[model samples]
Target chain A: MKEKEINFEEAMKQLENIANELEKGDLSLDESVNKFEEGMKLSKKCNDFLEKAEKKITMLINSDGEIKEEEFKIEEN
Target chain B: MEYNPITVTDLNKYIKEKFDGDEMLANVLVKGEISNFKRHYTGHLYFTLKDENSLIKCVMFKSYTTYLNFIPKDGMKVIILGSVNVFERDGVYQIYAKAMKQDGLGSLYEAYEKLKSKLSQEGLFDVSHKKKIPFMPKTIGVLTSNTGAVIRDIINVSTRRNPNVHIRLYPVPVQGSGAAEKIAKGIEFMNENKFADVLIIGRGGGSLEDLWPFNEEIVARAIYNSEIPIISAVGHETDFTIADFVADLRAPTPSAAAELAVANIDDVKETLRLYNNRYKIALKKRLELMRLSYEKQIARPAFKNPTQKINEQYMLIDMKVKAIQSSIQSKISEEKAKFIKQIARLDTLSPLKTLTRGYSIVTNESGKTIRKVSEIKTGENINLRLVDGEKKAKVL
Candidate 1:
């Protein structure tokens, strides 16, 4: 069975490696086909991971263990 | 000693006239080492011009001070252009300086320019030689005083931006004797040991004398030669130094340098999210293209009725088989008709047919239907065999 999931970093690294190998043009037809298939899977996985990510906000406190949770606003340029 | 009631301005004017008329006091060019210099907030410079034996106070307004390219420091020899004057209120004689120039190229500026030009010639300030600061540095090496607001500011800004960045402080004096050497050594050590991805060398804002170590040739050379990219953040924004020129990057303040070194974790996460979104969008587009192509292929006649293709080949074979069968049948029939004709032609010449037409097939009792007379003897019994029946007899 093909792997249905991969993290963003792993997928990106794999994609980069595949791209490099393809650029080198050393792979046989069968190997190239296999790599292309794997790259497609990884690309899909990365896209899926990115689509699901949401921005999370948290507050910072001093070493005294004080709780300070405030609404963090994203600054706009 | 006339007891005349006069205003302060009158007394000041009377004393100014007396000093202005004196030939020796007017337009005196004084040569002395400067001391206790203060640039007034109103843009006037006040300092004491002192010789080994005597000292006099002098003032140069903003109009004159702006013309000076180099900052005049304490103990620097300068030729002052001013006239002698006495204030009646304090009875103090002073040289109100109009202009001043350096007595000589002092030890500090000379060393500064010498090292700057040398390193610049060696391509230290070249853009190609400067290493780019990593977008997200994992660790930052700080070379500064152990206890100072500089470290605090750096920590505050960095942690605020990215909480996870590791900071290692290589404590060294930021000024005074041996300070430049220590700072240089710290930079070298951080680079040699690969302690951090980037280094922040800085101190808080201070007077030029306080920030002298950063201007030292040693510190500048160290920054120029550093393998790890260095961000020089010594003093305020207006302050420029040799270290600033040699460093891979220059930041106005320590906090700014820290900000440059690390990426905000939140911002990076957001960026990553955006990238992921873009990847997803691109993937979706590609898949749509693939799907469209697939649909087009499926809509093709070959895909719609695969059996039509098979039937076309099947019909070709069927036609060929029918052609072969028909040809074989016709060939067999034609040959059969030829054979029958041949048989009919043979029957006409056959002796059996002649026998039926009243010609006798002579034979002996031996039942040998003889083609020659030698096959039968005088008393031998023979039987004649025709195409319809056969009669047999024993040979005598």
Candidate 2:
């Protein structure tokens, strides 16, 4: 069964799904509205997630045992 | 010994019988690496099959060669099924090659080459034809085997990168016969149904044979023709396929492709917040600039010295009135002096001035001063008007 409450990735995926469904002109009005609401929630969640995140740079060892880190400067323009 | 001259047909039949009578020439199975293999101008094959020790010329005419699916190449190991026969003209014994089957290096490499060349010629890998992946895809369609780690990895990476991403798995066969067709159909079906904003068609790393479906002409064409942008993640980074070439975007793995397709919800929200803050800051700065200008305008003399402007106008009006009065006075005095002088001159020359000098105007009766005899009657009453007094007189 598909989860009703979606996580950030799931919500994004659902939002895209909703958009594509709307674009295709397949959904009924009621369904479209529900999908739109879901999409909005997902969009909000995405936005909120981004807003809360700081432009942080850190280093860690990867699965392949290679060390990687954020290397570029954050340009705040 | 008497030898009769044979007819051409008899001689040909006699030579054919002699060739067929060779015991060692019939029912021979020759093993050799194929060389000089050519599909002749007439669709016949002319080739030399040779072992390290010896070589034999061979020919499988067009009628026999038509059944083969793959093109023959040089240095291919094959076992030929044919009888050995002598070419009458060359007098050399050779294999009349028929029914060739691959003995080693199975047809996988041939299949790959065939499909690659076919798809390439059809413009499937044209850069101009590739669709751009959406900036933020909300729904990602995954086409792969459902049971494998491929789908799981895609879901995990997509969800972790952006929890809101919606994934729709369209499970398909990724290998063996009919797999390419199914994968192609999956792409078409998603596009037709509008299942996802972007599609991820991929599988985990595998051998070339395992990855062959992705490299199929059908799959490559389907990916190229897809209306929706596709991300190909068929194998490890080192592994390349026709699907990778034809896809809009190529990822090293299914997880990486998923990561690329969706934007992190947190990142988007943070950007929105930053934009809002910047907007507010800009608006405040604009208002402050307007206020500063307003204050500057208020500090100007026109705003501060309002009564001074009125007072200046009043002073101007007063100065004009005073100047007017003085000029009028001077004009009036000059005129009065001229009038008096004129009056004195007129007193000496004019009758009205003479009257003012103590002479009086006269009229006949009816209040007229008598000046001529015809204006007077014998008995009449007359009144005389003077500068200071009026008198009544009787005229006879």
Candidate 3:
């Protein structure tokens, strides 16, 4: 499968499906390696997403009848 | 009226039947403070509901306890909906409570109850209408007061699970007259702009009046119509607002809503690692199997040297050719021996050999051999031939 326009949830689901196919174990050697490469790329993509993720907290503020987003900071207790 | 007097148990049974037949007594709704509240170990609640002027004993069985979100305590004002029934053994009448709710909000409790049943009957709380909450929402829109623990707890819980999750706060009044409209408008805004992947709309625990905004019809309808899934977390665990019933999912508190919104990064990372490892192991196994088949091919003798088999065929052909050549030679020699033996026999039968053996052959001059003397009698002379010399003799 091509990696175009894929999200983390989709990638994760595809990886799991590949894992199940490999476990069933009727595929040829060539097919197995191809699937392995595809699954590996998806796994790597998911890992990169997790590692580079940043939390961006924002709030919706209405000023002069237009709604806009502003950065939100937590009030420390 | 005829009096059929008997035992006290009989009188109690008769009076119990009379109370059971009365429609007013069958469905009684009373508002009073709870006193002598006793929770039996068997899960029945024995209590006395008393106003300043009157009092009534109420017994709520274990089956009815499930509907009571809050535990009844002494002096807590509540409305009990039950029927007047008699305990025959005690010869006294008490109320069997079917449902109860915290009162003192006056008709606000009535409004809350009325809206709950109305929305429920409209199928707004149907499971089919519930939207699926995204497992990994990029942003979580929170609708609550900005000054309290509601927003704080949501932020902390969501970030703790996955630091990548964004919390977008759309602060609105949680109570008072117009709070419900603001809350409903916030839900609409989030859906219209596709603001957040999932919305968390809730506030800290409060009384029925304080949590009244969540129970409003407009807010419940907004939640029901949202394209984006919502997680309603109002008040405490026992609090059940109309929003909770209408939402796609309901969390008991704000922190729980946050937890439901985001997937843990560590766990997801672990899943990725597991897939990577499985890929390596499976690919290695496939490669190893291919290599073993290759090695098996190389180990085959015919595969090692294609000419070896041809060379073996050549050797077999040479052996067959040699056998054919030797068989022909032996046949020729056997024929040659038979020819030689026949030649020797011919030589032994030759007249020269007879002559050498001192045997004489007599014949007329015509070269014909005579076996008897009479055959040559007509001849005037008989020739006698010797091995070394010849002589002529006349016969008398």
Top candidate by lDDT: 3
RMSD of 2: 15.3
- DockQ, all candidates in order: 0.05, 0.05, 0.64
| Per-residue accuracy of model 2 over B28-59 as CA lDDT, tens digit each | 77778899888779888889998898888998
Give the fraction of native contacts in model 3.
0.74
Query: DockQ rank, highest first?
Result: 3, 1, 2
What is the Å distance of residue A68 in model 2 from its true position?
41
lDDT of each residue in B1-396, candidate 3, tens digit only: 999779998999999999989999999998999999999999999999999999989999999999887768898899989999999999889999999988876687789888888999999999989999987776788999888899988888888888887788998999999999999998998899998889999999876778999999999999998999999999999889999999999999988988888888888888888988887777777778779989999989988898999999999999999999999999999999999999999998887778778977776666577688678765356666666766676556
Q: Which regions in candidate 1 have their CA more than 4 angstroms from the true location?
A: A1-77, B1-11, B23-59, B68-80, B84-95, B100-105, B301-396
Chain B of candidate 2 achieves a TM-score of 0.57
List model 1 lDDT by residue over B222-270, tens digit each: 8877889899999988888888888889999999999999677677566
How badly does each model clash, as a count of residue pairs? 8, 36, 0
- How close to the true structure is residue A4 of candidate 1, measured as C-alpha lDDT? 33
Q: Compose the digit string of candidate 3's lDDT tens values, residues A1-77.
A: 33334576777889989997776667898789789888987787677667666788888897776998888887777
Question: CA lDDT of each candidate?
Answer: 0.75, 0.74, 0.87
Q: Which stretches of candidate 2 lie over 4 Å from their true place?
A: A1-77, B1-107, B305-307, B332-396
TM-score per model for chain B alone?
0.64, 0.57, 0.67
Q: Model 3's lDDT to the true fold?
A: 0.87
